[model samples]
Target: MVTAAIGGERPVRDIVPGDHLCLTFADDAEQRPVVTEYLSAGLSRGERVLCFVDRTTPGIVLDWLASTGVDTGAALLGGRLRLVPAADSYLASGRFDAAAMVGTVRREVDASLAEGFSGLRICGEMSWAVRESVGTAELARYEREVDAVFAGRPVSAVCQYDARLFGPDQLEVLDGCHRGSVEPPPLRGHDSLRLVPAGRAGRRRLRVIGTVDDRTHDHFVAALDAVLHRPGDVVLDLSALDFIDVAGLRALANAAARLGGHRRMRLAHPAPVLCEVVRLLGWDRTPGLVLLPEGDVA
Candidate 1:
């Protein structure tokens, strides 16, 4: 984003790298421009960027990047970003091999370093769950690893932790490394069902929006059965869903089928991952899904 204020042409994607990261934003928005610019600049320096985002709405950060037309793949090492799924998903990890969320990011960092990605970016998005997980030891270790990664190569780790979620010390670490802060607009998610519609339309609109691990897949399946039982009119509002495991998705599919004769149930709010999963499993015909604004998909 170019600004007359900065008097410079800058890509929001490449603004900061090495301890002296500088992201220039308008006099209006507080710290966001600085934060994203730092991420871009850090990536330009060949340092993989790690963003600690609010897990609840982590997609917002990425969505913002897309809006800014930033090459996030270059900014992130995997060409795809990583996030710690919901806190509950992590809690369920013990029962599943590939399901358990990374308990401590330090271990994940160590493993990644050992694997030698040259440049790696890990973002623990801001969320209530992430804040609880960021204990003293975990926070300290994470910082140490960031320093270690930099020492090994010109690595620039950037995590956009929620100011509300983190304590002084945690913020200190991100800021200590000179990682700029980017605050998202207020979260846009329904906290709870204000009034679950029992009508046919309500039933069909409730989209299945979560992933399930092996152990929980059955549980998820069981719960979906109840939703399935709620008559054919219910809809699953999945628009905000981030991740739903294969088995989990399968369970939802089964739910849809079970209600096929009785009612027409469908999914809504499909993130990219959701679409991929739907296609991979050959369940692409959206039954009761809702489309984002027309211009969103392209």
Candidate 2:
């Protein structure tokens, strides 16, 4: 049940074992950063990483990792990183089989653990599924089955999808099979604010950095709206938020109230002023609005 913001390395870096993430990109320009960061993070954390390559060669993928300052040679030499060809793995036997693929992943995870690695991290380029031998329904089924394998296991996976190759309908179907999608780009406000989605302990979070006042109120609300659409309780990580006016605080309270049944909007580590306003206005008692103590935001 791990999830992440639509975009950014921070979110990807936060990915823990047992999380299955879907990443969609338009081209190599958009894909390189995310893929490299994900692999680098795993390697840094002592995890054995396996990257299944399609639409590119192993050499090229290695180069991409090297360019990101990764010690590619050392990682490969230590048996901590493997760049596999998709054809020899995912599409082996000349076609895709969901059960076989799931078993393959399970075996990989077990092998990594046996080898004394912290855990297993996988990144699969899924463009090969577009071949004639592969069926859309089978692709979706494989993703769903893989998700089951990842749950509560010492394995984390990211399925990379090329938006230019897959149609919107097919992409939507596949995206729904994973815990969450990693968007290609981050959402930016007009130089005043940035809202990034993140997850921790299976809870969805929106990291709000920068100010939230009259000028940036609309942007903040829009970002909040987008995050609210996600299933489960939402945590607004205002740890880095510089300032927030009363209007912004009210919006959070209102949103929490709207989410009435079991779902809550948690304001994590909000500024002192914001807390005072909530107490002064008696919004602290609002049913779904929770104000977390300073050190508890993370």
Each prediction's RMSD to truth: 18.6, 11.1
Candidate 1 regions off by >4 Å? 1-31, 41-52, 71-118, 121-123, 126-134, 167-298
Kindly provide the TM-score of model 1 when superposed on the true structure, using C-alpha atoms.
0.35
Residues 237-280 of candidate 2: C-alpha lDDT, one tens digit per residue:
88889998889888888888888689778788887888888999
lDDT of each: 0.43, 0.77
* TM-scores for every predicted model: 0.35, 0.61
lDDT of 2 at 247: 90
Candidate 1 residue 278 Cα shift, in angstroms, is 65
Native-to-model Cα distance after best TM-score fit, residue 279 in candidate 1, in Å:
70
Compared with the true structure, what per-residue lDDT tens digits does model 1 show for residues 53-81? 43435466666565667776544555334
Best by lDDT: 2
